[model samples]
Target: MSDHEVVDEKPEVESTPKTTETATEAPEDTTAATPKPEGNDGGEESGDDMPPLEDIKYDDETDDAVKKKRIVIPEDKPKPKPAEDGWLDVLDNGELRKFVLTPGAVGQPRPERGCIVAIKLVVKLEETQAVVESESHELTDMIVGDSDLFQGLDLIIPLMDQKEVARVVVSSRFAYGKTGIPGAIPPDASLDCELHLLSVQWLDEEFVLPIVDRIRIGNRKKERGNFWFGRQEYSTCIQCYKSAIKLLDATDEELESLDTNELKEHFDQQMKGEKKSPEDEERVKELVDIRGVTYNNLAMAQMKIDDFSGALTSVEAVLVTQPNNVKALFRKGRILAEKGELEDAIKVLKTGLTLEPDNKAIAQELNKYSAKRKKELVTERDLYKRMLQTDKSSPPTTPSKGLWGRSSVTGLGVECNC
Candidate 1:
């Protein structure tokens, strides 16, 4: 159908509903939602755009997942411990410090006493097994449980028996602290030392101190041994010789003060070397002769001091080396005399005189005894002659045989009186 025709026909019928006059107010005032700033997005802002800082609250579900980060420090960290049967890490810094329990308990527990120990040790750096120092000594003693030691050593000694063995790496604080073993180690350094407890006993007041000082001095010498050897080889400068002689002389002086007669003699002989100048062959020979002379003189001193055995040994050595030595032969004779072997003494003296016929000292010694014997013989002979003369001067008087009871005899001719 033609739309216009049907619509006009229907509209002409005036299809309109009854209108009740209902009043409608104007649409309430409407407001539009404002757009947030660039920073605020659903309530989230860029870190830069946010205030300097703000605390953000979190939910329970996320709290457990977000952990509190913690920092672990090595120094404060708990040290790993070991079992009693096994090796224990007593200390741990850059290196590991360990202590081992001995088989038997320490005998005569002496916390207050101290004793010398002979130790065989092998030292190595951390994590690597290369020995930096290895040695054995019949010395080095520590007072047990005393803090005057490396911390590691202090711990180790208390746990050891008299003959126990303890292995350890001494920490920096225990070993050398910040300043390490001067030329051997740097500052804040650690060292590994194996200590074997060879023995223990009560401390000897006189023995401990000198021995400790000796050990420390020996350690210093060990540190300088190679250097000295090299210097001795290539540095024969007069200054070096002077320094050596100074040391030798000082040793001699110390021995002399100690009354160490043998040691003093050794030092003296070593110090009194060949003269500085040898102008001729004779001078050189004289210089060479000094050693023998000093040796003999020392032997004589020993003999004077009643070190008979020592004197005998020294003189014997000299005789083996120099059979024709007058000094040695004379010294032997003197020693034999002191020992009360006058026969042996006379023989040795005679042999020496044969070798040194014109030695006035030897001749004088022999002549002194000879002259005394001759004077005694002369006195005895003169006494006998005097007895004979007395007999001749006064003739014997005999009584007349039968008749005369008594008779008097005169000298020269018998004159009787009855």
Candidate 2:
């Protein structure tokens, strides 16, 4: 039989009327209508080629349970390492760090507020160690607490002394921060700096030293000025003396109220009492003497530079403190003479001579000006005499023009030819 033929062992039963009754009675049974073998024509079961389907059923409990379930995932993160040792937490705020490469002078005066400091600086990237800006040879002057330097530097420089070199690490918050300088530093980049403190000039404390030390320092400067003066370095000498004078706490007006000897006597009297110490008295005397000498040297330098007016001022300062100061008096007289104030010069020289009658220089200056004055007086007298004789020899008269075409002298009544 062909594979398409249906074989039935109950073929005799299907031809019977009972089989027809059974199909009519179960007319709604479609499963019985189509009959086929469980296997295909190839004799392999078709059911084996496909998997069975499992029934899917749902309830409220099942849906609630499904909604309550959560998915958990592991996150990946980097671990932080500990900070390196031997780094100083500068600024105490942890925004800056420092490591000293080399130390500078010990016990030197640190910079104070409003003082100007000179520094050499280098800036680099903290990560790549790449140089960003460097100022090595040319030192930049910054005023403490008042300059436009980086805030980190302004905070750090006050702790350092002259000639100090340090390596500082500034955090991004303290450095240029997120908005860094274009073309110079990167954004949000930490900076590495190499700093050198060169010099400091404390303007606030320039005149606040102890009187003894002030006079001692002034004397030292004056000695240096004398050395320079001997070498004919007039400009340098003037600068040194000026620096010495700037150390004095007294003003020109204050020094003018009392002469040097009177100041010494008053200081001695004050010392005898408990008001001032012996050391203080000595310092005051020295200061007064040194100030007079400084003024004299300054005047001499000014004269050398052809600054006669400046020389006059300096000498007058000296004369104010020491009215009998011979050098100051002589220089003042000379300056006056140079300025064509001969009368004032004569009076100044005469006063100096009264103080030192035996001074040959003063006497000679007085005699010279006196002789010049006498000569001037005689010339004036001769001029007046000539005018008087001419007026006396002629009477008031008017002359008309003669036949010649020449103007005649009227008062003299003299006629001239053409």
Candidate 3:
């Protein structure tokens, strides 16, 4: 779920569903930083328009062909003709087709990969044109490539311009895949969509983006992670969380190192945050919140997939920023317990309990790990001690050679016992 305020729903047409989720940020790459543009909505065209329909063959011989592909508009049905002033784009033998009803605003930025996009859309069955699902203009924020979107939408979104409204038809192979959503959509149904691109957020452009925009982007990613987590997709969930962490990672190492009181206090306040606002301090606080939650969620998801080592790393990231974060400590303790590090598990659980004195889960974990450690210690102690003593007391003996120069079973040897 992302913070995209959902206003309505229909038969599910969009590849990714609308969710109300807060997101997290990733580290910035400024290697090719461009000058801050005048507005957020505008970009160079994707240059991804495939060859004309006549140039493509829908038969099985085609590369990345869709088997038993369904036609978007049957030969007899009326087809949309792009207005001379608008954008018409197609790909993959018509698996993806975009006909822009409204041209993008002049000078508006077109979203690219790694950008966050806000969109409103309704999906329908192509033949019947019956609506399946719709997210209202209130919108949903989708991260371009990372959204776990259907292949067609994934390919089409980056080519869209902010505030541009278009009609999109994605084939079954790129819509819901071969096995479509049960009850909501029939198998092999191409999705007919009316898409609205409301805005875009450039994560890497530092100067052009307002702080609030960045905060929203990070939080949206966090919520997207939650969406995947809810579906029991642990790997995808972890990826969403890590993406947020990267977005929220401190961009200026030197400034963070100054150790100024105001800066230190602000960082501290992020964990114990103040009221939300749009100012830098408030935005920073929001980012920290998103980062902590993202890491915590990442650790939990990793644990689900039995990636205890990775889970440990994720939780430790939270612990680095918020040492007393009980959730991180709890997750770390669980990861350690999974790794059979009962001692470390017990220690972390104990620390967490001290922080949240009334926490019963931590208390239980502490008791369980402590008992396990005690059991292990008691079982191994005397046995290892006797073996050590015997080894120390006994002198080593060399094997005597047999007739064929091989070591013999009756060779001279030493035996030791308690």
Highest-TM-score candidate: 3
Q: Per the 3 Å backbone cut-off, how many clashing residue pairs does candidate 2 have?
A: 0
Lowest-sum lDDT 10-residue window in model 2: 2-11
Which TM-score value belongs to model 1? 0.28
Give the winner by lDDT: 1 or 2.
2
Name the lDDT of candidate 1: 0.48
**Residues forming the 10-long window of minimal summed lDDT in candidate 1:** 2-11
Error of 1 at 314 (Å): 41
* Model 2: CA > 4 A from native: 1-161, 165-201, 205-207, 249-275, 390-418
* Residue runs of model 3 more than 4 Å from their true location after superposition: 1-111, 116-118, 125-142, 148-151, 159-165, 170-190, 197-208, 250-282, 385-418
In model 2, what is the error at residue 218, expressed in angstroms? Answer: 1.3
- Per residue, candidate 3 scores C-alpha lDDT tens digits across 381-418 of 98899999999998666556666666654423532221
Q: List the residue pairs that clash in candidate 2.
A: none
TM-score preference between candidates 2 and 3, better one: 3
